[model samples]
Target chain A: MPTAVTPSVLTRPDDEPTAAALIAAAVETMAVHGYHGTSVRDVAAAAGTSPAVLYHHFESKQRLLVTLLDRGLDVLIAATEEALDLAGDDPAERLGAVVGAHVGVHLESQRESLIGQSEIRSLEPAGRALVVTKRDVQQRTFERVVRDGVRRTVFTTATPDDTARFVSAACTSVAGWYRPGGPLDGPTVIARYRAIALDAVGYRP
Target chain B: MPTAVTPSVLTRPDDEPTAAALIAAAVETMAVHGYHGTSVRDVAAAAGTSPAVLYHHFESKQRLLVTLLDRGLDVLIAATEEALDLAGDDPAERLGAVVGAHVGVHLESQRESLIGQSEIRSLEPAGRALVVTKRDVQQRTFERVVRDGVRRTVFTTATPDDTARFVSAACTSVAGWYRPGGPLDGPTVIARYRAIALDAVGYRP
Candidate 1:
């Protein structure tokens, strides 16, 4: 596993300041008030813009949320992919890398990650489907690695699918309780989670 | 561990039909639209009552949510306590029983569980404090069990607190993906989670 792996940074093009501001405001408001609790007006007010300007950028409040959720998933997916690429051929190393990256992303993007976890129900069916599809891609990455490990006799878990799900859920939940300056630092969290994932899978080495 | 272990059931007194209806409606609506997305009017309509009646019962939407969240936590805490009581003195049995009961409650009380997980942030400070206090009790239950297991040398985890947190988070998260009529049934899910939790702690026996 890579020693210096960092979460993929969430950045936008330099030209979209107003849009960026609106997204930032939405993250802040939604983090506090939730999706149904937050309004386009609230996001606009927080962004120092009018509802008309908010509408010009995104068709509706749900659309703005969809945009933000998509971006958050993008960062998570990118980070996981980068970690896996650097993890080499051993299934244990790959599992550690992916779990590390998963924890890293959720820690670095707590609000966005929390929103993504909580507000998927708030989206329209189409938007929900879009986010679920991205989420499934990430899920499949873990599933495939675990299945491979089992096939190779490296992971002794009786239920590969369930083990993968448990590891992902355990890692995903870090966002709910993790504080930025909390006792555990980023690399420490990443490393501990990697150990937990390995143990959960009954890793041989 | 008790062979006939089951999750504690969440039941309300049959006397308060209107209040019960209101609470039930709130659970359903909040499950779909979330705490902030749900409104008193919607819950009232669903319960076949008026906003005044909802107010008479719950005082406000937040109050209704706080009530719901409190009830959910009560059921969870009761289940865990009962499981611990019946689990004998073995730390592995204790861990299995609690994880089993936790998964059982979340599966049977999916809507309430989902709402409780997502809506804690929607509570006022006093209500949030009350709920957090209850939540901490449940968390400490797991922490103490794992710590004891470590002391007894039945669990080989280097970090008992983190392992406990990971196990609880992993079990709590089953509510997010589990479906009643899905591929796995409740007992199967519970059994799988017990094994996963045991493996997570590196159980020696």
Candidate 2:
């Protein structure tokens, strides 16, 4: 139940360098060294700035991590929402879209996805709650699709909730091992995942 | 790829304290602080022993992690093999058994499973290769069942290899979120995963 008791603060607008650049620097440092292994000084050094500059833009090291995680989740949720829209009304197609979108986004932003998934332990209570809440919202989109499919007899699973969980787990794992120029391209991988997701739900045709 | 260039060494057998106790200590420490964040001193403290005692059992910190990971994978492979044996001839049944045993074993040894999955990056080349070979062997078990099911038309998947990967990913993720005394018990969760596995391959029965 530990929470980051500090209120969210805006990055300094008048800084010499943009906050976006600072955030990008933090992401790279964290991605390579892990959250606990990296420090504000390390990030600033990697970013070609000083601790004073970093502190000017962000309240603390904890805040930098929370911001990065929140931004990553935001990007993921937005992309998946768009995919759901394009999927239209068919539950099977919708689920496939969800899988493809999930895999594609994770692979596209592999580092952020890796940090977001792995570093939940590093967050304080409030930051953790915020991230979890956002994650739950993303999970609900998949759950709703599964529930719809089951209700309509279009798809069948013994446990709908766990079904959704498994699908999320499977898709998210692409980030762990997938290489951009490997045997499978983004579309090829997405197609394969779509097949797997559809097959897992007992979808026919 | 960065490989741990050092060759694997045999663990010391004649150490003052048993290797098992030191391993238990290492697993607990790595589980909390992560591989990079932990040191020999930290593990010794957790194990209630001195660094000299730890060094007697494990050659170095890297060696300690590699040993722990190897042991974890060995235990996992053994348990899954037992599950496969109980599953007998039916491909659907075999697949179900794989998922059930996977989730069950992961939940039972959550910490080791977590560390095993996450810290492969920390291993040296020889150690990394050793671990990857063992992991591939474990992966092949699932692949064989899926391929068998597809050949028999008892289960259908467009890409059997990808299907196996997805299933492995999904089942391993149970260790991430499952709580021991949560609403669902071990068997209940396993049964649910069994259904998902069966459905993923389009198993009719």
Best by lDDT: 1
Strongest candidate by TM-score: 1
Give lDDT tens digits, candidate 2, residues A1-205.
0121111112234534546556777777777777877888987776667889889888899998898888788887888899998888989888987888889889887878888877887799999999999999889988888888988898867577889999999999998889988899989989988887877776654
- Candidate 2 wrong stretches, greater than 4 Å: A1-18, B1-18
Model 1 Cα shift for residue B191 (angstroms): 0.8
Query: lDDT of model 1 at residue A169?
Result: 95
Candidate 2 TM-score, true structure as reference: 0.89
Task: Please list the C-alpha lDDT of all candidates, in the order they appear.
Answer: 0.87, 0.80
Cα RMSD, each candidate: 5.7, 6.9
Q: Give the candidate number with the greatest DockQ.
A: 1
Cα distance off (Å), candidate 2, residue B203: 1.6
Could you tell me every candidate's TM-score relative to the true structure? 0.94, 0.89
Angstrom error at residue B12, model 1 = 1.4
Clashing pairs in 1: none
Q: What's the iRMSD of model 1?
A: 0.7
Query: Under the 3 Å rule for N, CA and C atoms, how many clashes does model 2 have?
Result: 6
